[model samples]
Target: MSTLRVRPSTVLFAILAVGGVAFGTTCVEACLGPGRAAVRLARTARLAERLQLTDLCLFTEARYTRHASQADRHAAFQDHPAALEHFPSGSLMPPSGAANRASP
Candidate 1:
């Protein structure tokens, strides 16, 4: 069987083709990176503009309302002296009069 020999020009052409592809890919990525980032930023800005973050019920507000009303209920249960005894002072229960206080 005869041995096969690869020509220098053919090898050079193959190497150049691979190098050109790599360089072209890098150039395309660099060109599109900033454009992609700007698109994402614009989408985020549009979503923010459409949604009202401030109007949503705050965690603290919900917690305050829940605990304050609980305290008021506990206060009302004062007639049942045994009920107040179940929850010790400084425990999970808020202060008895917190329900009437102004919202922060």
Candidate 2:
């Protein structure tokens, strides 16, 4: 009876080769994925323009923070002027420009 034996180095080399192939595939996808999606993106953009789409909804946690343009400046702090933000999304989005401006 004959038994086939594989060397440790051969196993290591095979593992490394598979990893390198995976990394290369990821790099190729990263580079070309956007280009492939550009057509769909443009079509979506055209549809949005035709429909006069408003600001994109970012968070579903609260109505005030749902859409940036539609957010109320003081809604996040409605509970108290110095109240800590309750919604996780509140920390993610920065105060809108209008909120930072002084009222005349």
Candidate 3:
């Protein structure tokens, strides 16, 4: 059998293929690493946010109209810090009678 010589085009294609594979794998590794880290961090952040909300709720009551606090239903957030990138900005105003009795 005669030896076959590789053409310039073939050599270029082979180089491109190798480069693509290397870059593709590298990009995947770099991307996944940061993405997973972000997810874990987000989970912790969300937990902290929820805890803060619960703490606030524990010490306060909410009402939408001129009525004594019933403590049954009120407005609630729809997203967690982990599942969402942005949070709605607003302060939960004290109910008509809600007061801060937390120890001084």
By lDDT, the better pick of 1 and 2 is: 2
Count of clashing pairs, candidate 1? 0
C-alpha lDDT of all candidate models, in order: 0.59, 0.83, 0.52
TM-score of each: 0.36, 0.72, 0.32
What's model 3's lDDT at 85? 19
* Tens-digit per-residue lDDT, 68-100, candidate 2: 666677888889899988999888887766766
TM-score, candidate 2, is 0.72
lDDT of 3 by residue, 37-67 (tens): 9989798779879766333333323233212
Which residue runs of candidate 2 sit more than 4 Å off their true CA positions?
1-3, 101-104
Better of 2 and 3 by lDDT: 2
Q: Report the Cα lDDT for residue 101, model 1.
A: 66
Residue 63 in candidate 3, Cα distance off native in Å? 51
User: Candidate 3's error at 42, in angstroms?
Assistant: 8.2
Top candidate by TM-score: 2
Q: Write the per-residue lDDT of candidate 1 for residues 1-104, one digit (tens) a residue.
A: 99999999999999999999999999999999889899897887677678833222312323333344444544535658564443333344455354556764
Candidate 2, 6: how far from true, in Å? 2.1
